[model samples]
Target: MGALHVLSGGAARGLIARLREDFHQHTGRTIEARFGAVGLMRDRLLAGEACDVLILTQALIEELVVAGRVLPDSARALGLVRTGVAVKTGAPVPCLETPGAFKDALLAARAIYFADPAKTRAGTHLMQVFQRLGLMPELAPKLRFFNNGSAALQALSEAQEAEAQGVLVCTHMTEILATPGLQCAGVLPKSFELATIYTAAITARSEQPQAARALIEMLAAPEAVADRRADGFE
Candidate 1:
């Protein structure tokens, strides 16, 4: 196998690391990945970056197919992701089990953070979530958009130190829960939850098309599900 280059978004971050390890161990092929925000990855691919595989949202996969950048038949559903909220570690996790409780938490927080929709799908849906919950007007002014949740987590820690209620990010950032300064507050209530389906496809111009296809298949296989689950991916 030649270089199997992958272009992927942050949603697949932790999972990609695990997959790459498994792929190399099994096939002895180097898996090179470029991770970015979803929109950034999309734009880069549109600009003709030579990517063998793309792991992104279903909509993005469809877009690439329509643009003739990926074969329509090569698209495969990988997993589903839902928005989760977390606060800095040790900060009191206010109850966000209901719509009203969520609103109260948002209002009480001094600064809230989520990624930008221009870069991530979570940020896109988070805007709609605020609207759907009817708290957009009140919360919009306080919103501080981030490029990634890792940075938001840093800020959250600072806020906690200041005794200010911290931020909420729209990501399946469960891995961050183990960090010393953070913990999951709670996922938004079910009624307001927005789930995004993640998918993978082989790029049309990939020189290693077969290897790309094989990689996708392996990642979606039953054995891979255990690693996916371990990484907080559903």
Candidate 2:
């Protein structure tokens, strides 16, 4: 059988990786997966990328279904994933119980890493948090942006080893939990919390619709709830 082509948001990477072998065993087909920012994944699908299955924000999946890019009845939500703060493993976890504390933590950090604001849900919300706190100018120099949360967290892990002081990252909670050498401090402060529902669907052009649906079922199966929760999916 032909491989199932998948384009997904970084938030689902860990869950998908956990299920890949099982899905392949059950279906006798391997998966070819590409994961990145939701916006970039949407753009890739719209740009004629070959995708049998697509995983992205629920709203984006709805939009694609409306646009006839994804089958209307094939979408199924994985779970809600929140925006969160993370630190390098073994580093001191910052207190972010309040907006003021969150702002202070950002100010105290030697650097801040996040996904591209223009291309990611968490990144955009994080920038808004900075704006609301009136620290945009002061934090601009310390900010570093990457293509997606996974990349930002990876860089954060590497940077913390070289720097003596604290570094902070804000991204999807799932991404934080999935990355090695990182520890999730907590979700964003209540006022700035962003919980996004991620969904998976079969593409309209899928050559293996049955396999695509099977993969989606595997990802959102009731039996996998504990695994999803462990990965920071609500």
Candidate 3:
């Protein structure tokens, strides 16, 4: 069988990778995934990138369906991801039990990293959280932006190893939790928490429609969701 191509966001990367092995084992099918920021993935699809499936936030999925870029009926919710704070292993975990504590923890960090707010939904909501906390002006100077959460975490890791400078990253709990040697400080406080529902759909240009639907169904299976929860999905 031809390999099914899937374009996905970073939040779903690990869970999908693990599940694909099981998928191929039992079904003798193959899946190839391209993962990155949701916005970047959407842009690639809009620019005519070819893939059998698209895995990303529900908002992006809706947008693509409206644009006729994905089959509306094929869309299914896979899981929900929450925003959280993370630090390199061995760093002191921050207290996030209260909104004031969350703001204080962020303010006290030596360097804070996240994806570009102008380009990623997670980053944009993070910016809104900062604004709500009245820390934007103070946090802006300490903020470092990257192409995606992975890059931001990479940068944070390097800074920690080389300079011992304390650093924190803000992104989906799933991505942070998946990164080796990174410890999730805590989810964003309830008042400011952001949960993004990730969904999967067959692309408009899918060459393997039946295979794509099968893979999407596999992703929504109870076993898949259990794996997702273990990876920090809500």
Candidate that would win on lDDT: 2
lDDT of 3 by residue, 27-139 (tens): 67888888889989988888888899999999989998999999999999987888888888887888988988888898898888999988888889888889988898898
- Candidate 2 structure quality by residue, lDDT tens digits, 114-218: 998887777888888899899999999999899998998888777737682588988899999999888888888888889999999999999899999999888
The deviation in Å at residue 166 for candidate 1 is 2.7
On the 0 to 100 scale, the lDDT of residue 103 in model 2 is: 89
Pairwise TM-score winner, candidates 1 and 3 = 3
- Candidate 2 regions exceeding 4 Å error are none
What are the per-model C-alpha RMSD values against the true structure?
2.8, 1.2, 1.6
Each candidate structure's TM-score, on Cα atoms with residue i matched to residue i, is 0.85, 0.96, 0.93
User: How high is the CA lDDT of each candidate model?
Assistant: 0.75, 0.90, 0.85
Find the candidate with the highest TM-score and give its number. Answer: 2
Cα TM-score of candidate 1: 0.85
Better of 1 and 2 by lDDT: 2
Lowest-sum lDDT 10-residue window in model 3: 156-165
> Per-residue alpha-carbon lDDT of model 1 for 1-234, expressed as tens digits?
567989987667677666677778777788888866777888888898889999888998998898898989989887876667877666678898888998898888777887776666677878887787788778878888887655555566566455545555556543354234667776778887867778899999988888888889987888788777665567
